[model samples]
Every structure is written in C-alpha cells, then in structure tokens.
Target chain A: MLVTCLPDVAKDVGANRILKTRAGHFHHPFGDPSRPEASERRWRLEATKKALEVLTEPVTEPTVFEY
Target chain B: MPTNKKIRVVHYVNQFFAGVGGEEKGDHPLTFREGPVGPGLLLQRLLGAEGEVAGTLFCGDNAYAADPGAEAAALDHIERLAPDLLVAGPAFNAGRYGLACARLCLAVKAGGKTAAVTGMYPENPGVSACRRQVHIVPTGDTAGGMGEALPKIVRLGLKLARGEELGPAQEEGYLPRGVRYNAFAEVPAAQRAVDMVLKKVRGEPFTSEFTFLGFDRVAPPAPLKGLKGKKIAVVTEAGMVPPGNPDRIPGSRASTHHWNKYSFGGRTELPKGSFICIHGGFNTVFVNEDPDRMLALDALKQLEREGVFEKLHEEFLSTCGNGGPVHVMKQVGQAMAKEARAAGVEGVVLPAT
Candidate 1:
C-alpha cells in the first residue's frame, strides 16, 4: 500500500484508482492533481489505505519517486 | 368465575443470556425441547402470578443473521405449541438477539393469535424494526431491569386478554411498542402541531402520536459452491495498526483504527512477526506494533507467489474498522476491483468480524 501524498504518483499507479475522491471529512473537495497541494496527499493516503486492505499481498516497500 | 389459567408466555434468548456460549451458541438454529431453559426462568420468575413462560427457544445470532432459512426452520421447530404470547429477549443492545426477538414476536402475532406479543428493549436497532408488529416495550439497558419490566409487559398482556381499551403508553407506563391503530384523528397537522406546542410550552408531558417504520432484511446470495482453491482476500474492520504508522490495510467494519502496512514486492515468502485481529465494531489495537501481523500483505504475497489463487492483485484497499462511509468506501472498492480485475483476481473472502 503505497501512501502517496500526491495525485501524480497515485494516478500513475494503475492500482490507486480507488482513491479518486474530491471530498474530505471537513466536507472540502480536494483540488485536482494540476492544483496539487499537501492535503491531497491525505486523500490519496486515505484511498491508498482503503485499497491496500483488500490487497492479497504485502507491499514490499515504497520507493521515493523524483517526479 | 372459572379460576385463572395463567397466560403462558414463551421466552427466547440468545446463548449468552441462556448461560450457553455467546457467539458460538447463536451459530445453530431452531430446535425444540419442551421445558423452559435460559433466560426463560428469569422471565417466569419475573412474571410471578401473572404469567408463566410456556417454553423457551434458543439459537445463535450468526446462524440467523447469516442464514435466515435456517432461522425460519428453527422458528418452526420452536412454535410447536402455541402460547398466549411469544417473548424474545429484550436483547438490550445485542443486534442479533434483538432482531431475533423482533422477528419472532412479529411472526407469532401474525400467526393469527390476537396474542399481545412483547419484547424488552434498550434501543437495539431491532426495536425500531419489530416495534410496530409486536409489543416491543422499551426498557433499560441490561437484564437488571428485567424484574421491573416484566410486570408492565404482563399488564399489557392482561389488558389484551380482558379486551379492555388500553391507554396511551405513558399513561400505562409500558414502553411504547409503536403499535398504530386504524382510527384517524380528525385534527389536521396544523391544529395538532399547535396543540403540541401549547403542551410543550406549559411543560406538559406529551407522547408521539404516531409510529410506523420499515424493516427489510436483504438476503445474501449463496456462497460459491467450493472455495478449496479459491484466491480469497481477507478483509476486516480491525484497524491493523496505529494511525500514520504507514497506513496498513483495514480488517473490520465495527473495529477501530490503526496503521500497519509495510512495503512488498519480489518477496517469495512472508517475513515472520505480524498478526491479525477480529474486529466487529468492538475494539481496535493490533497493527500499531508492526504491519506484517495484520495488513496480511505478507500472507497474501506468499500465497500469491505460491499460486494461492492464480495471480495476487497488487495494492489492497483499507480503512479504519469503523464503517467506512459508502461514498469513499465504494470509490475505494471500485479502485480495488479495478486492480483485482487487472490482476485477474476473483471473489473476495471477508473475514468474520
């Protein structure tokens, strides 16, 4: 479960498609990737967490992406 | 007067109250043996001179909730001899027990006995579900309130037997079972609202004049014929680990939050030192120490490599054991499905919470 704080990385992964939500607990919509910010990472993390729970394998590790 | 033949009320209770095992007992369904057992004795003791529990029925919550066909068959086994009224555990807050009571009371009342069915309650969701059909009187939260509750319920039953016009719930001190009548009051909503406001302003007590709610239990589809070699994915509401502990996957719907995920890739086998938990909105605390124990990633990875199913999907979905809201959960589910589909995964195996 790669907890990407950015949409670019999350969207890049064919697996993180489930984390595509614009809303947060505070009832705020997360801006799209073009307008990326730190909070979007939380949403991406939330999505990643949920998606990863259903995975049948442990994520070996997350490699830092320069992009 | 031909003296009294006491009203025989049948009591139903789950395994816990019956002094049987808890969840384990509720796993079986509908069997009948004559005499009373379980909470039946306590109920009979409470009824004293007014009523006698004719019989008792016991079943597991899992069997009923998981398999209603078995539940119905079990009920058939219990209703061998009709009593004046059928009683199920007030259930307090136990969802399955409360539901069983509500359902039994409803079925008994419907079986053509003008019998005054009653259930004790402490606001189990089932109270709302079966309140309208049966005399599901409200009560305090535990068995401690049973004594005080019994007489009141019995009184309601007597009124039904005597054909006496029953007063409003508050007037009679019985829990409002939410039963409605056919007679329509002539007052319009405007007038009624005004009257209600006046009473409230005067600090006068008032009762809700109407109550009827819907209850639908959707049956689950049958399980796949055989799972001997299926590529099963175990999901739980158990918060696998502490928050921000690197976002481990979820385990239970009713459990708590924890983080426990670790990275995975070309591992041929799971590294030791990780565990899983059973969370049913009960408690949370497992993933804080390490991700390997829960998140079950290591297990899945090993299984995938071993050809557990065919190909293991990458990136499991997760959340706090708390009911992940529908909107976000569905989005996450769709994402997982997409991933699983890509990896050629099949049906999932949701661990029992």
Candidate 2:
C-alpha cells in the first residue's frame, strides 16, 4: 500500500493501489506533530480508515482512497 | 614507484568484527582504535607497503539504529582521523551490518573522501541505499567469504584512493548503482540494438548496455463487498510496536527476517500510552501521542463495533520501512502475505511511511 503525500511515488513504485492521506509521508501531516484540535484529528483518522474501501474496489488501474 | 607515500586508509566495521559479541552486543556504541582491528588486519596484510591501515572505526548495529546522533558521531571521528581512503564491511548477508557499512561509506564520501563497502548480495539494502555515493563490491552470502571479499575490497579501495579511472560495474566486479555515463562506443547504438534483437530472435546470449529495474505489478484484488463479516488486518512498515519493543526490532533498516507481529486480541481500543512509534524515519512525538495517526487502531476498533467487518486480525504486522533494503522488505511482505492468507484475512490496510 502507498502512503505517500506525492501521487507520483505511487506511480513510480508500481503500487497498483494507492492511498493519499492529508498527512506528510514522514512524521505528522505537514510535519506538525502538535496535536491538532479534536476535529482535525478525527478528520485524519477517518481519512486513514478509508483505506478499507480502497481494498474492496475493483480497478485495472491505480486508484486513490477518498474518504 | 620510487616515492614512499603509502595510502592512509580508515576501515569501518560493526561491533561483531571489533571482537565484540554478535547480536547480543549490537547495542554497543561507536568506538575507534589506533589501527586495523579484526578484519582490518586482513585488509592491512593485503595493502602491504602501498597502503597503511590508519584507523578503524566501529559501531554496534543496534546502537547505530537506536541513537539518532550515531551518524554525526561517526562522521566526526572519521573526519578527525582524516584518512586518504575509507573502507567498510565485507558485511556478507548481515542486513543491519551491511546497511551500516553502506551508510558509513556514504558519510565518508560526503566528507570528500573515497569510500568502498563490500557485501554478499547485489540486492543488499545497503547497496541500494548508498550505491550512488560509494563503490560496493559484491561478495558471498556469509562471512566465510571474507578471504575472497577482502582482497577485492582492498583492490577497489586502492584504486579509488589513487584517483584511478574506474570502469563500469560489470568490469569492476561491483554492483551497478543504476548510473550511466556517455562514452564513445565501438559500435553505434542502432547497430547494437539490431544485433541484440537478432541474437534474441536466434535465442543466443546477448547483453544490453542499459540496465533497467522492473517492479512487479500486482493488480488490486476485487474490493471486498459488504465488510460486515470479512476478516481484515492492519499492516505497517511504520515501526509501531509495544512500548520498549520487546521483539528488539531495529527502528530502521530492520534486519532480514525481523518483522514483528503485535497481538491486538481482546482489545477494543489501543491505549496511546501502551504503544510507541519506533520508526527512525520520522518524528515520533505525534504518533506517540496518537497511535491512530499511524495505525488507525482506534478507528479500526470503532468500525469493528459498528460491524464494518467481522473481526480485526488478532495480529498486526510491523517492520521499519525507512530506508530498508529492497529484498528484505520484499521477503517481509511475501512472508506476511502467506501468513495473512492462511489466516483467512480478506483485506489488509498497509500503513506505510
């Protein structure tokens, strides 16, 4: 599974399936480790949970995880 | 040949070759000695009068991974020693050790000194990590090949130290770093391609001057329909493990065959305090504050309660993905895939960093 902030990483790494998250590829999203407000954290969490949907979709090409 | 200026060489090795214990002593910190210790002696003998083993620097495999400052510390020592050439590892198949050697070579090169490392496989993670920065000679899979590997490493080190023009990897017996140079060839490219195609058509041996790396294309399986009763799992290369990481998994560049499985059974939610991020690739403060950032464990548990899936797999697979060797990462994925399939896991959420 791809967890890159850059879409091209998924394309280059040959990951047939990809998950684009709001968070940075390394450390916290945008490199901000300070806990965001509860709502922001929830948004990030929900976005991550959407990975399950990516697994079930049938696609011949690369697809993104949209929550 | 009349002038008597011997090449001063600095050698690097893991704690194991420094006469320290094996994996048990991998936590030993960086240290330096006056001259050739352990394998350095072999290198010294081979250098004869032409080169001198100026110094030997060593570090523990696990220590290097655990300490964030290890690289800077090592660079400091090497810079102070200021040898003409730096040599690292005939590390064989030891994944962590091989990677350390490669990184050291890269560090040495960054300081404007030529460095070389040797290891067993062309695919060793260290080779891929620092190939662009250093020359890596291929060796056998075990330390038993030291006799053969050392001479080759010495030969390459001497050449690099002398600023001699080196040939391509194939001719030099080193792993190719996927770099190319423009040079006048004996034949034109169009003619070479035609000859190559002709040879291929005739089923004869042929060689391509350009080397391209191909990755496996795995089509996504049909998405799970109705998540209510399907078994799902969370896998990560983000290096999240139980507090203190009982498995002793290195934070980054996880050694070959060192993936850890954490039990998630009987827990509806993971306590933030109970888990920590050990991945050396990123800042861990936020992940430690909220494990869900990396694992989405809380969300997965909530989904389970909401009947999004039948059951979360009792175990979560984890390994450090940061700068890990390609082959070792492939092996980990393959081994885990087989295990997940056997466990009847229909879907996996791989959180990568």
Candidate 3:
C-alpha cells in the first residue's frame, strides 16, 4: 500500500514506506469538492496513478515517490 | 488529622529560566540551589505558608538533552532533596526546555519518593511524548503565558502533594491522558445532552464528554520481497458498505472505537450495484459513481488477473476514519493487523479519505 502524504510527515512519522505526495495529512485529499471540478479529477487520477507506480517499485529501504 | 508540617516542594527549570546565559549556557551541567529561583520564586509565593520550596533544580536545555547521564544525576539530586512534590517547567513554547521538564518529571517519578508534575504548551513535542506517562498541565505557546500557566501548575502540584483526589483533566485544567473511569454526574445523560445541544444551537462553546486524543505514528515494516505471489488486500476508511449499509457505521464523526469488517472472499471485483460510499466528511458523488474511487477494487482485480499477486485477501477491514479517537484507532488498527497476519495476508493497501 502507498501512503500519500508530505515528506515532512514521512520523516516526522519515521515511516519507512510512503509515496510522499505534496499534500497535508488527513482525509481523501483528492476527494475535496472545494476545488475546480476538472482540477479535482486531475489530482485524484494523478495521485492514484502515482500510487500504482509506487506499488510496483522495489527498494531495500524507506522510499519516497520521485514525483 | 491536620498535620502541622509544611509540604516540601522542589522546582525545576532550565538554565535560561534560572537566570543563566541563554542558548550559550545550554551546555552547562545540572545545578542545585537552596530555595526558589526565578519563576520558582513566584511558585514558592503561591505555595504560601502551606508549602515551602526545599530546593531548586536547574540544568541547561542542551546539557540535559545532550547528556545521556543527566536523567540519573538529576534524579539523584532530587531524591536527596526528599521533597514531597516535584514541579518542573511552565515551559511555555520552548521546545527543548519543555522536553527537559518532561524528562525530569519522568525521572522524579521513577525515584519513587515524590509525585511529579509539569506544564508546557499542548503542542510541545514534550507533551506528545510524555503526556501519557506524567501529569502535565496545558500551558500557552509562549513565555508570555507564564503568568497564567504557573498558577495552574503550582495549584495542581499542591493538590497532588497534599494527596487531594484529583479530577479529570478537563476539570483540573490539564491535558487528558486518555484515562477514563466510572463516576456519577450531577445531571442525567438525557438532560446533559439537551443542555449541550441547546448550547450548540445557540452557538455557544461547549466541551464534549469524550475528547479525541491524537494519533500515534506507526513505523512501516521492512519492505517485502517480490509481490508476484504475495497475498494482498485493500481497505478503506471512506465508508464503503454494501448497498444497504449493513454495519451502519456513521457517515461522519463515526463512533470513535468501532471498525467494521466486510468479506469479499472470492469476488473478482466489487460489483457496481453492490456497494456505495456513505462518508459524510466529503462529497460522496465521485465514490458513488465508482466505488473504486476509494478502494480501487476493480483495479486490484485487474492486477490480480494480470498475476501481479498470487492472491488477494478477500476480507476488508474498514472504519469511518474522519473523527475517530486516536487511541481507539490505534487499537482497531492493531486488531486488524493481527487478524490479517493470522489470515496469512502479506500486505495491505489502506486508502484513506
């Protein structure tokens, strides 16, 4: 599973596995309806796609998403 | 039963608070002095004739944090003082000083002769790390709040020293440590609920009976080898339930401790008509259109078909993540992990909303 969160959070939590997304911790970030409809969709799809990529990568230690 | 003896109190502070040089003196070692110094003077005055400051303990924040032996040496000094109560900090926003105070409290308690108490900003890392183990009052973020904070800290310390029965954190003005026990209330639950509801309706502030303590950080386990044949499962805290909402988990502000489990044992994908999102924290429209928006069961099924993994754990653990208490969430997660391990599930993809 990919944890989509900020690098600071990844470090603060000291979690070895994370997909370091550029967002704050909490809730379905991409599911927020406050943003423009198209942008919201783009963010959701992009995050999900990134998570899938993270799922396939191999690493010996704690890894962060390149994106 | 009134004893004529005055209660002995020990006050602890950092070098800066003790009238020593600021950041530069932080490397200085621990020092012991007779009677109060700096803020301790105010605390001593607050104690009045009922209690006396037997000694003041001072250490540089850097010294305390840097020296691994500081805790033992400090405790040795405090134990020799033989004070009935230990008072540390009112540290305000100083993170290092706050942690120093917290560590001193723990060390004092370990000495076993006196009760220890301290105060710091609720947001202090010290508070998060040590709150569960000691009695800490919630103070303001800056030293400016000291006037208000010291009195509370001293008062609470006095109560503890005198062996007075203490009230809950809310009533006593300290940070809650997730401790709960049975006690009678002045009003019935129905009446209290109505009173709280009325206050909410009037837009007046009211405190809830149950408070949410923050979450704990769980470190990730070592990376697993090859996913080609590992058993994986997907879970969600987005309130996905079978179409009829069988478990009835609340859509938002769900029960702080309840987590429900659903089994999809042999299903290739979550059928379009079989599930729905009921999470009240956000708009559910996107998830309703495709339940996969939350857990991505269909995608997982596709990956499974493509042989990404040998098996998918059919059972899914779930809860409404939006507003669950941290302590309860930890317990639920622990239980879920234990069950997954027993079921031979190798990994989990937890999608949170």
Candidate 4:
C-alpha cells in the first residue's frame, strides 16, 4: 500500500497523555494529559510521531535493516 | 630432490553402488576392497595423479538409521584409511545415501583427516546436518553436476592439503566449511592489532573478516521456588512502562531504563476496565485483564501477603515482548533487574513464552 507523507497530519494526531481514566472513546489509543503518568505518555507520542515521519517518504522506501 | 611423495585419498560410499549389495547392501559392515572402480575411484581422480584410493569402506543407510550401534561401529572404517583427503558422495539426492555420506564425512573429519564431502540435492539432509560440522561442497540437485562437483571438492581439498589460505565460501563457490579460526600475519600480528586500535581510537571503525556469531548466553535466574511464598516481583515482555514508556524504549530492542514503581493493596487495584495495554509485541491485555489470575502474581501474592509468608516483596517489572531479539532482550532484563535490585527485592519471576 502506498502511504502519503504530510507533516501536518502527524502534528494533528499529536501527543497522548498518560494516567488516563476509561472516560470515553475520545481518550482512545490515547489518554488524558492531566494524569500523573503524563511524562511517559508524552514520550510515547513523540516516539510514535518520529517513527511515522521516518516510515513515510515521498519517493523511496525507508531503510529497513539496522546493524 | 625427492618428488615421489603421494598423498593418500580415502573414499566412502553407500552400500547400493559399493558392489557389496543393493538396497539390502546397507547392512554390509565396514569392509575394505582395495580397488580403482566404484564411487571411490571418481574421487581418487580429483586427488591428483600423486593421489591413490588407499581404501574403500561400505555401510548401509538402513543399518545406520535404524541402529546407532552400527553407525558407531562404521567409524573404524574411515579411521583405518587415515587418508590425507576424504571424499563422500555426490549421493544424487538419495536420502539414506545422503545420510551415509554425511556420517562418514563427519567421522573422517573428527579423526583429523581433511574431509571434503560432495552431494547433489534437494534432500541431502546430511549436507545440512553436517554442514556446520564439515564442508559439504555445493552441487546440483541432480547427479549430472558430478563432473563439476567432485572436481571442485578435490581442488579445495588439495588447497587445504598444501596449507594454502582459503578465501570466503561464496567467492570460491564452495560450501561454508564452518571452520573457525584466528589469523596472525607477518607485518607482525601485534603491530597490526596496534594499528587497528589506533584507528579505532581516532573514532574509526574497522571490520574484522570474522565476527563472533552472538553471545546468546542468559544465566537462568536462581530458582525462585525457595521464595515460593513471597510476592515474587514478576515481569513479562508485556510493555510495562511508567504509563507510556517515557524513556521511549524502542517497541522492540528497547534501551535499558529505570523501572517505574506502583504500590497496590486496598485502593491500588489494577482493576478491569482501568488498564489498557500498549505493548506492540503480544496481546498482554489477556493477562492484564485479570492481572490477579496469572498464577505467579496471584498465587504468590496469596501465599506471601495473605497467609503464606511475611509482607509480599516489592513492585513488579515489565517490558514489551514482541520482536525482541537477543540483544534487546538482554538490555530489557538488565533494566528490570536494576530496578528490582534497588527495591531490595530478593527474587524475580518471569513469564515464559
């Protein structure tokens, strides 16, 4: 499948917070920013964002093998 | 100058064509008929004009496969030849034949003769089984490759006999002989090593032609059965982090990090509907759903905290499991163990896949 790269799309799907309550579907594969565990949650979101940026390129595929 | 030295070549073959017998030939014990015909003669030619087929040994595949006793006895046949170069098969994709060739080649090699084996095939189980054990020259899946096959084996065999340096396997189109070694050469190995170290000291990385396979050693945790009553702080590849892995541990080969602690009792229940799993490896949710259900944690907690022992040990540990290969697994364990030790925990229990 072809994937499109857009900087704004990643920004929109942005950071998730930790220590969330099972409040609603809105706090999905994401959580609320107010919890005590927010630091871990934000770190995860940033990492995911970086990974997505790496995977989606305009022309070629990303290098898959690592030493 | 004395140029009359001839290196002896030993040939091994299966019973069918050895002329001792046919399908029933596999029972023909190790008997030597000094001759220049049979499969052994083909190998003798490759050993050079100076080489002689000093011995021929025969054994049946059925006998070897069916009885370990017979296979063990067959080792004597190759040992008797004491050849400089040993050759076994272009077995032509035959199953029992392939195994016989493999077994004989291994025996010859173990006896310290330079053994070179050849085989054709899709089902040369012996080629693969003995591959890491000996050099099974690559050949066609059919016997037609014999002309090209045995010649290559002989060339390589002679090279080793002459004590010539061998190159990489694919470059020479030979099988990976799986011989491991260290190299020392005349610029002086010590000087060359110092040169390498100097380059590395200057922030340069050089490649070594040979690399150690991998250090997959994991010393088993001391048996926790003695602490069977303690709340043995348990862990898994379940992606357990401080809520969201602030350390940004790679979902796979995660870096080592400090463990986040959680205290549980009256108010601290990891209740259903309260926890969600972020582990990308396996569906840890199944266990987390009823954390108290997984035996080590629940049963141990019951024994230690409730009635079995004193206060159940401290916090639990965890990490994502999916796709964690050797290196990553080690790093994660190091991190988890560090935290567990800091908490004064006596022992740890880990989930097995």
Query: Fraction of reference contacts reproduced per prediction?
Result: 0.00, 0.49, 0.19, 0.00
lDDT of 4 by residue, B1-353 (tens): 12345767666677766776778566666556675447566777666686788776666778767777665665665566666666677676787778877877776677765645555463466665576676666777766777878787777766655556777765665665555656565687677778888988998987554533333322233333433333345554545444445655455654555234444443233444333345565445553553432213334444454443444455556565556654445666667777777766654434322
Error of 1 at B219 (Å): 22
lDDT accuracy of residue B97 in candidate 4? 78
Against the true structure, what is model 3's DockQ?
Answer: 0.15
Error of 2 at B305 (Å): 16
Off by over 4 Å in 4: A1-67, B1-5, B177-353
lDDT, model 1, position B31 = 52
Global lDDT scores for all candidate models: 0.51, 0.76, 0.74, 0.52
Which candidate order results from sorting by DockQ in descending order? 2, 3, 1, 4
| TM-scores of chain A across candidates | 0.32, 0.63, 0.62, 0.31
Per-residue lDDT of B1-353 in model 2, one digit per residue for the tens?
22256888888889999998888889898988998999999999999998999898888998887785787788888778777788888788888887888777777787675555555566566766776667888888878889999888888778877777789888887777778988999988899999999999999999889876445566667767867798998888878888888888888787767787888756765657667888887778877876766776777777788887788898898888778766677788888898889989988877776
Given candidate 2, what's the lDDT at residue A10? 61
What TM-score, to 2 decimals, does candidate 3 have? 0.58
RMSD of 1: 15.7
Query: Pairs clashing in candidate 4?
Result: B26-B60, B239-B319, B239-B320, B281-B322
- For each candidate in turn, the TM-score is 0.45, 0.56, 0.58, 0.45
In model 3, which regions exceed 4 Å deviation? A1-48, A52-67, B1-4, B215-353
Residue A58 Cα positional deviation in candidate 1, in Å, after optimal superposition: 27
